[model samples]
Target: MITVVTNVDLFSTFQHVLQPLTLKPLQVVLAYSGGLDSHVLLHLLARYQHLYPQHAYLAVHVHHGLSDNADAWLGHCQQTAAALGINFIAEKVVLNVGRRESLEAQARTARYQAIAKHLNNGSLLLLGQHLDDQLETFLLQLKRGAGVKGLSAMAAQMPFSLQENCLIVRPLLTHPQQMLVDYASQAQLSWVEDESNNDQSYDRNFLRHQIIPSLKLRWPGIAHAVHRSAELCAEQQALADEIAEIDVVTCAHSFSGLNIAGLAKLSKIRRNNVMRFWLAAQYLPMPSRHHLDKVWLEVVNAADDANPQLRWQAGEFRRYQGVLYNQQQYAALKDVVITLEHTLSQRITLPDNIGTLHLQDLIQDTIHNKSGVDSSNAIGDNDSGCCVKAPLAHDKVTIRFRGEGTCHPVGRSGSRSIKKLYQEYQVAPWLRDRIPLIYYGEALVCAVGLWVCKGYEAQAGLYWHVTRER
Candidate 1:
């Protein structure tokens, strides 16, 4: 059951919730919307700011260009914030909606992205989602038969952005819609009413205006009870996350991927749990259940040489030599060859701006057999040094991306084809041609980020060590 709350009582609640915030230094920014809920939140925050002057307070209004009154809303937010003596920032964002996609979802995504740009290392993005909104979210998730994570609905506090370290807090989660409206009326705050909110074509509006009101009439305490259930789901989700975390470390083949052998040992549900958690933690879009099933059946369980891949909107899952790879984007490769001069201190930029390279000093004593020589620890003794031939100005230092040659890298027992070496290094087939091969005259000398030919091994006394930095 919900209790009738006075504006004073609401202020007390807000003050109580904000106590934890003062322990650490944070830039507090309100996600302001010129609505009853947000207006009340803004008013209360403004009032509270005087008591806690140590914390920085700011407001950001996202202008999602869907409504004709968007400009007016922006104006209202700025004006109101000015009257309250608060700093205000307004951001305009374009919504790119697909023909069949939900315009609401796309607008929300665009709005959050625009807001995310303003948030940095230590930011607290205060949102104005109240109990009614939480109820609506829970109902919607239920209708769609969402799992624990989804059914947990919006938390009072949670990580806001996938790309940035920010926290979104809904301090008014327990504040009823009536309490906010009453506060707005008592304060005589001016707010613009968006006409789109009344359009029942939107699912939220339908639930808010048409469905939830009728349900509330019959069961007045439903919102509070549902919120309690959501809280319980949140606890359950946390426990599930703990199990997944332990399992992830066990299943990891390399740094980030699940070893198919380790993964196969888990039950199907556990595997799915880890996969979903892994994707979400890595900031990659989680595949739909259908797509996840396809990946499990086709890619993870496929033959060693199957080379199966699954792609969705934002990322792709690939299998490379018995390991799974989730790549956010394929690196753009360039075919253009670059000409560079060899100088000890000269750093050359590679073509297509792939990366930068330079001579990383020369070492004595270590004629690099299998790499891993510390140039910093180079010994100057002639007996320990492999004498290197300095590049003559007449010899053109040509850098080519792709070449057909049978060249031997220094200290390797036998000469292998470059194509074979690329495979041996497990370089992606599409990226092989993009690895720049360095040549002094017609002799293949080194492949940047790869190997130096045997003949071109750093000769003693100040032999050059090629270093590639991306």
Candidate 2:
């Protein structure tokens, strides 16, 4: 058992010092599992909410539905939240702890994913992991032989770029488990002990029960020391990021995907860092060290004309026609076309553009900020609707597969081939095939948002619309 401290001054941490500059007036969601650590965190957040009423607070409990007592634990969590006068939400998710993933890691990923659903565009998701957890993570990274980034471990606060927007803030990284237990006892808060946590079958458990304790007995402050080492590594990582940003700009070209020619000029270490930075920017899974070596040999050393390809778990990368493209393989669009028979007067959302469709929905006041409007025509009084036809379904509107075509943009007198247009607009080849084209049953109405034919002009009073996005 770990020795406990009676009191914890939560406000003295590095985070509190940086709170003025860092903290946003956003919702704070805690991944509460009714476990010792999360329970302590939930209590701290409750206290924090009382202090800062401007920021919203919520406790999310994810029910994996794995344990027999899952429902009972959820009930306990609900009661605890009610007693604390904090909003509580629960989510149930299925976890398949297959051969590749341990039950602990699988459950962790699912639980956090569920908690992330409660977050909004500017919210903060706080986690309860402590110093010991950081040490374990460091050991795991070492076992996998990860480089500097992995060794840096988790950041104290970092923006999490999920579809459900928020930043994942780890405020408890500086604290140890004993400090949390001490705080819980002093605060008289009750929390459940997960039986699975003690099971030696899990790798983390084995490390916690068998290895860490033995190591701790020899060096009492091992976890803290390791935590310090991780901090230093983290600082080094920030420096690396600074250097990488500069290198990336120098070695990159807007036209040729990632300038493989420019990348070849840097030393091997700088080359690897630049590659990793670019991959991170694209959100592709970082390739293994060996894979990076392979890519370097292929991209930098191979003949300029050679097309090289590298693939990993998340996505694939290919070089073609002096431009390298990274793509996530997806199913091809169905050959079928679906049409809406709604009247033009009715506000109808087109099939593909989920965000925007009709002209009325467009922000009139914000029109000045937007570019690429047909400027030569009237002083923007009537936004072009393409054709002034009476409210009728007579216009053969169908979503068609992108095919070889010639486009005569509204202002341009002559037509240009699709391939040439793509080049002129600097649209990547992968994006060209992905752009949706609306067809008037053989005649291309518009390249969605790209360009509309000069022949099809929207006059003052009729109804027509088109939209597109990157």
Compose the digit string of candidate 2's lDDT tens values, residues 1-470.
Answer: 11224557654452383366336677778888899888877776666666677777789999998889899999999999877778999999998756576677788778767876778887777788888899888888888888878888877878776634567778888787888877788778899878888888877888888988888899999888888888888888889889889998877654225776677779989888888887787656578888888776775456877666677676667765455556556445546454646433334443333223443212231354343334334222323334332323457665554557687877777989978977765566665655555566577766544566666545442333443221
Q: Per-residue lDDT for 1-470 in model 1, tens only? A: 11224544777888888878657766788888787778888888887787777778888898987888899899999999998877899998877665565888887777788777777776888889989999999999898778888889899989875324678888889877888888777777788898999999988899999999998999998899889999999998898889899888877653256677777888988888888888776666556678789888888878866878777776677776656667545355445556765455445666553445444335323444433444544322222222234566787776677767688866679899988887776565655665666677888777655566776655343333333221
The predictions' CA RMSDs to the true structure, in order, are 8.1, 6.2
Q: What are the TM-scores, per candidate, against the unseen true structure? A: 0.74, 0.77
The lDDT of each candidate is 0.73, 0.68
Among these predictions, the greatest lDDT belongs to 1
Give residue 101's lDDT in candidate 2 (0 to 100): 62
**Residue 428 in model 2: shift from native, Å?**
6.2
* Candidate 2 global lDDT: 0.68
